[model samples]
Target: MNYRLLIQYDGTRYYGWQRQNSTDATIQGKIEVVLSRLEGRPVEIHGAGRTDAGVHALGQVANVHLTERPAEEIRNYLNRYLPEDIGIIEVKQVSERFHSRLNASEKVYVYRLATDPALHVFERKYMTPCEEPLDLGAMKEAAAYLVGEHDFQSFCTKKMKKSSVRKLEEIRLEQLLGEIRITYRGNGFLYNMVRILTGTLLEVGIGKLSPEDIPAILEAKERQKAGATAPAQGLCLKEVRY
Candidate 1:
């Protein structure tokens, strides 16, 4: 039977979502160990996204084939044995054809920046502290340039043999109290793409780069032309829509 899992993890301590040969401290690795023990065979969890180290997920989805069993049993076993940072929010019997990654139609990622640290106490761990007071108007202008279909090779750090062209449908920047949440909705994103976009937007906010420079940067197709990749802690996989 194939089971679908709704997952949420802090990702502060783990290496990332994917299972690594080097360490068993990954989110997927830890969950697989417990499920493998319960089923008396090796179990694999296929996640929707491979988030980088220190990145988090609020509504991550995954699928795994397991022995015929109650979905609640699997969820209970995972939550009871999995580490405190990881939690199985929901589990359901799914079709064998369901694949979390391949079936995903849109991914929503949000980057949180603390405009003032003292005001945001509870969400500090998930947010990145930005001591500088950013120019909100400038940042929004810069974000506008990033929306739409574009080849975002300049925003990605990894060298991929496949195409880097992506359809970035929206970029919403919202400021609430002392935190600024920047949401990126797209068909897909490259590795570190959101973070790099955040960093480049910050540069525009701080007057390091102008909003008009966005076109040239995109046209460059060089990683060096973009801004630094923002810290991983600020990023969170908000949702995966099928």
Candidate 2:
């Protein structure tokens, strides 16, 4: 039977959601190992997206196919076998044609920044600490420039295989206390696009880049011309919409 799973994880210890050929552990590898042991057979989990190392997910979706077991019991059984950092939030029987990666229509990502000198040790795992004050208005203006369909090659890493054009549905900036949250909704993204976008917005907030420069950067389509890619720890896969 085919089963769909809603997953959440802390990416601190894993090498990402995908399995790689390294001694370093991965979230997928760990879960597969646990599930294999439970069912006495190999099991594969297909994720909707691939998050880089140290990146987290709050509502990631995955599909798995298993035989000889009831689909509804998969979540409860996996929870007992999987590690603490990775949890199966929900499970349901899905059509055999349902593919987690191909069926996704849109995704929402969030980047968090702490704009204060004092660091919260606990929050360090999930937020980027910016000791400088952020210009809220400037950040909002810069975000507006990113809300449209554009060639996002400048914001992505060069290692991607697909086209760089993407439809950005929304870009919003919010400041609460010392934390700044940047929420982005898009049809798709190239590698590291969210991180680079966050860095570019931070540059605008810090007076290093003008809001008008965003359009020009998009026109350039050269990764070197864009701002630096921020650390992956502050990024989260907020949701996936079908």
Assess each prediction's global lDDT (C-alpha) against the native: 0.94, 0.87
Superposed model 1: Cα runs more than 4 Å off: none
Please, what are the lDDT tens digits per residue for candidate 2 over residues 1-242? 78888999999888889988784388888878877887789888899998988999999999888774666587888888787988889988889999999999999999988776265567888998887877889888988989999999999887457788999999988877778889999998888899999999888989999899999999998998788899898899999999
Score every model by TM-score. 0.98, 0.94
lDDT of 2 at 135: 88
lDDT, model 2, position 234: 89
Point to the candidate with the largest TM-score: 1
Error of 1 at 18 (Å): 1.1
Where does candidate 2 clash, by residue pair? none
Best by lDDT: 1
Model 2 spans with C-alpha error above 4 angstroms: 117-121
In candidate 1 the C-alpha lDDT for residue 147 amounts to: 95
